[model samples]
Target: MNESGNPSQPVNVNEYDASHIQVLEGLEAVRRRPGMYIGSTGERGLHQMVYEVVTHAVNEHLAGHADTIDVTITADGRIRVADNGRGLPVEVRESTGMSAVERQLTELSFAPKPRTGYWVFGGINGLGLCVVNALSSRLTVEVHRDSHRWTQEYEKGIPISAFTRHEESSGHGTAIAFMPDADIFETTRYSFATLSQRLQELAFLNGGLAISLTDERPERPVRHQHLDGLHAYVAHLNPYPSSLVHSPAIGFTSENEEQTIFVQVAMQWNTRPPGEFRSFANSTRTHEGGTHEHGFRTALTAIINDHARRQHLISPDDEDITAEAVQQGLTAVVSVKLAHPVFEGCTRTRLGNPEANTYIQETVREHLAVWLDHHPNEAAAIIRHILNTSI
Candidate 1:
C-alpha cells in the first residue's frame, strides 16, 4: 500500500499482477498454460501429471493406509491407479460447501492438509488431482471405505452428479479410473516401459512399498515389485560397490542428534570422471542438484581431507581432491527428507532448501569422519579406487 492509494511498487506492464493474474476457470487455463502446472505439455509434462496423481495415491501408502499400488495403461487410453489404502475421503467440506467426494473426483488441485484438506497427498502443485481431472475429459473415483462402496463421475473436472453410494460388495481400498482428455493432450495414451521404469524408481526409494502394473492392452500386463528400498536402489545403480569398497558398502551416512535435514547417501564410484550424482528432496528426485547437494559435497570433500591428514595419506604437497576426482566412477544418491521441501523453481527440479546445506555439512562432518576412522581398511580402499578409477 502506498500514500496515493496505490501499491508501494505500482505494477506496470513489466510486472506481475491484476493483468498477470490468470483467471482461468474450468480447464481453459490448463490447456493454455499446461506447463505451469504439469511442467510441460510434452512427454516430461505428460508424465508429470501421471506421477503427480500417482504420488497422491502413494502418500496414502506412505501413511501406512496402503500396501499395494497398481498402475496400468489401458488400450482405451485410460490410466488406472488402484491402491489398498483407506480410500479417498468423501465427507462434505465446509470451506467449498461441496462434498469431499466431489473435490477428490472433480476439483482437487493440490494435496490438502487433513481436515483442512481432509487427506494426505503428495501433489506438487496442489492442483495435481484437479489438473489431471480438468485435462482429462472424464475422471472417476471409487472408494471402499468402512465397508461402503461408492463412485463418482467427472467430465472435464466437473462432477456430472454427486457421489452415489452403493452397498454392493467392494474391495477395502480406493480405485481411481480416469480417461485422459484427448482434446487437451496430443496423445491420451501412455507408455508401459517408461512408466514401469519410473514406478520402479519410486518403489526403490520408498522401500518395502509394493506396486504392480498390468498392461492389459498388450494381451499381458507388465508387472514389477521392489521390496529392497534404497539398498536395492544403490545396488541397482552400482552393482559392484562391494568389490570397490573392500567392505560391504561404499559410501555410508553420518547421523547426529541435531539433524535439521535427513542426510541419506549411498554412493558407488566407478572409473568415470565427474562421478554422476542424483538427489531427492522429500521423495521427489531433484534432477538438478540443490542446496542440500551443495552441503553434502562440501562435507564429503572435508571429510576426505581430514581423514587424509590423520592417516598422513596425502602428502602435504599434493593438491586436494577435486569434486570430479571424488565423484569419478561414483553413483551417489543423496535423499534429504525435510519437513517442507522448497524447490528452486516451479518445475521443482532443484531443492531451494537453504538450511539443508548447513545441516548436512555438520552431520556428515562429524559422523562420516568418525566412521571412516573405524573402517580404516574400507576408507583406504575407496581412496585408492578414486585415484585409480579415473578417465
Candidate 2:
C-alpha cells in the first residue's frame, strides 16, 4: 500500500495467462514480420519475392530435373513462373498432415536441404516460396504430375479454396502466378531491366539452364536468353575487337572432393579501364569481395609477378605487381559451389567460409601457372599490361 493511498489493488498474476500470449500460426508470423523474410517492403523486397520463386525453378534445372524456365510479367502486374520439372508433390505430407503443395505455400520453416552434388541452389534457406505466399494478395499454383493436373488458390497466405484435381495431363511441370499486396509494398511494378540482368546472370552461372523472361506490359514483349555460358558473358563485356587484348578468355574448373567444393574461373585482359570481377558461391552472386575473392586476387597477383620476373619483363628490384595493377583492364568471373556454404549474412552477398579461401587460392595458382607456361604470347601480353600500369 502506498503512503498517500488508502489501499492499492493487487495485481492478478492469473490474468497474464497463456491466453494473453498469442501464438502466430503458419504464415501468420511471416505476414507480421515480412521484412525479416524478404529484407524489406520496398522495391528491392518486391523484386526479391520474384527472385525467390525463380531461384526454385533454376534449382530444379541445376538438379537435372528440368531444363527450361519461363518468367513472365503480365500486363496486369502479375508475375508468372513456369518450369518443365517434376511437379511439386500433390499427396499429403505425413509429418504435417497437409498436402505438399499446401505446406510448401504456407509453412515458414519447411525448407529441406537439397540432395548433395545434384543442385547448387540459392533460395535462402528454402523460405522463399513461403515468404512469397505470405506477402502476395493473391496466388495460384498449378501442378501437372502423375499424369493428372492439380490446382490450388491462396489469398494473403490463406487458402481461398480446396485443392482441385483435373483430367490427366500429357506433360509434367509446375506453374505459379501471384500478385503483390498493395498494403505491404510501395510499388508492385516489376523492372524489366533488373529482371533481365539477373536472369541472364543465372543462365550464365548454370550452363545450359535455359531461362526466358517476357514482359507483356510494353508494346512489344521483350525476351532474353543466354546459352553459351560465362564465355558469352565475357564476350558481351568486351564486344569490340580492340577491347580484348587476348582474343579468348581463359576458362577452367577445379574441384576439391574432400570439402565438396567446385571452382570455375573465366578471365581475360582487355584494353578498357579498370576491370570487373564477378564472384559467386553455389550460384548465388557475391557482390562484396569475401574470402574467395580475396584468395583469387592473391593468387592472380602472385602468378603474374612470378611469370613477369622469369620472362625478364620486370626488374628484380621492382616491387611485386599490386592487385590493382594486375586487375587493370581484366574481366573475370569466379564461381564456386559448395555442399554447405557459410555466408556473411542472410543476404548472402559475401562468403564467410575459410576453407573456400584456401580452395580458391590453390586452384587459381596451380592452373594459372601451367596456362602461363603454355601460352607465352598471351602471358607476355598480360605481363606487359601490368608493367605499364605499375609504372
Best by lDDT: 2
In order, candidate lDDTs are 0.70, 0.84
Worst 10 residues of 2 by lDDT: 219-228
Per-residue alpha-carbon lDDT of candidate 2 for residues 260-375, written as tens digits (9 for 90 to 100): 88888888998786877799888788988688999999999999989889988888998888989899999999998887788886676898888889999999999999999999
RMSD of 2: 3.4
> Tens digit of lDDT per residue, candidate 1, span 262-308?
56677665544455577877677788888988998888887887787
RMSD of each: 6.0, 3.4
By TM-score, how accurate is candidate 1?
0.84
Candidate 2 wrongly placed segments (more than 4 Å): 1-22, 94-97, 116-121, 219-223
Error of 2 at 111 (Å): 1.1
